[model samples]
Target: MEDFEQPVLSVRKINKQYGGGCASCRGPEARGLLKNYCPVCGTVYACRNISFEVYAGEILGVVGESGSGKSTMMECLYFDQEVSSGEAYIHSYKNGKANVFAESSQQKRYLRNHFLGKVYQNPLLSLKMNFSSIGNIAEKLIAAGNRNVKVMESRGKELLEHVNIPLYRMKEAPKNFSGGMQQRVQIAKALSNNPPLLLLDEVTTGLDLSVQASVLDLIKTIQRELKISMVIVSHDLGVIRMLADRTIVMLDGRIIEHGLTDQILEDPQHGYTQKLVQSLL
Candidate 1:
């Protein structure tokens, strides 16, 4: 029980909705519709006032099926997608007093470059396919203002090695590697800046089972070694069981239940959650 009164990351009332709302979906006059969508307006409420806290060195798992807005939430946090309305605070940023969503473009860039790291499910989104794997790591270091060529090379090698990327192939382009290898390179690059918080959006989703296990093990090792706080999104309950200390279950753009992973496993309150856990068995 570290002091979670001060969270590494605090998110409050974050909302993301696609399309304009009609009278049937707007404000106090709103009526609920099918699965986070308004039939009258064609408005999809991707995330509805989602809020959570991530404390230092703890992994918070967000589990939801496709279209549940778990991925949308991660995108919003990383600023890949803008929020319709929300507030998020990072303890390392302005002493946790500033709302990141309201920050200027320059300030947000600074936050992304220095305080946060993200691993997208698609390696193409994260890695420069043509650049040498080590060069990919160097690119992130450069963004963080590391100008020393020798230092950058050393750090890159160290990270790639940590992720089980052979130094021999460090000069190879990610485009030439297998999917799991490409993801390993992406992980190396994400850690290059030594970001305090890491956001992983379905990193192991499309990998082979063995490869997923390897990546998951590597993640556990890194969390143990670096004590980095992580928010991992997965549709797979097994992945959440293995990685998350605390788990939040999301459905139809809202969190229906959240608790200790074991507690949720042993005693799920929500019908959807019960079904999800039963599927694992």
Candidate 2:
């Protein structure tokens, strides 16, 4: 899509690194030591100069292999992990003028609760195993400053229903549910705040093929009904092809190609991307 209107989310030159870089790996292009690691200093360059935009009500997919840093980028966007260096702006936050990465911890928490939602690949990261599925959703609502138990409960039940979780099971704990059920609960919890933007990191990674299809359908339904912008990270190009309007192909911690999903799949330019598409077929 054209950039005529302001994007819902804008991120520029995001770089996340672990450990200090040595001279041997400073200028990654010149050094080229390993995929994203510097054996010299034991530093791992997880993400490097990644940039992209997510327009209002659109899904932007980030596809890559395990070490390609797509998940790291998602973590940075949701503030689950701090960026080593970058600027990110959300249209609803400070009118898209302020850099969220530079915001205070309290401000980030505010954004997470009121402006953004994230569903982790691992339900353990976001869900309280012992809490009722509805209670998990209520926790997010409470974080967003909702104090009325009746309102929270009503909202939680609505979300669970939307995600296809039965009302009778709303009181059940996620620990007692199946993997697919737990993911559905997480999706319900993520949408509890009705945030404008959603971050999905490897959401369908570890599920049966049939279960994956169901969850993918649930995500598509949520996107259509909510019309919310999303940044979905996955190692599976097939998932990206099915869900994303626009896609970014990342390799070696950097974006190798980005364009409309169909265009990239039909005429992938990068060697890595071509292989990815081929494998998808």
* Best-fitting candidate, scored by lDDT: 1
TM-score of every candidate:
0.97, 0.97
For candidate 1, write residues 211-244 as lDDT tens digits: 9999999999999999999999999999999999
What local distance difference test score does each model get? 0.93, 0.91
Model 2: per-residue Cα lDDT over 1-281, one tens digit each: 42438899999999999988878888747384688888888888889999999998899999988889988888888888999999999988898999999999999999999999999999999999999999999999988899999999999989989999999999999999999999999988988888889899999989999999999999999999888888998888889988999999999889999999999999999999999989988
Clashing pairs in 1: none
Model 2 regions more than 4 Å off: 1-4, 28-32
Alpha carbon deviation, residue 243, candidate 1 (Å): 0.5
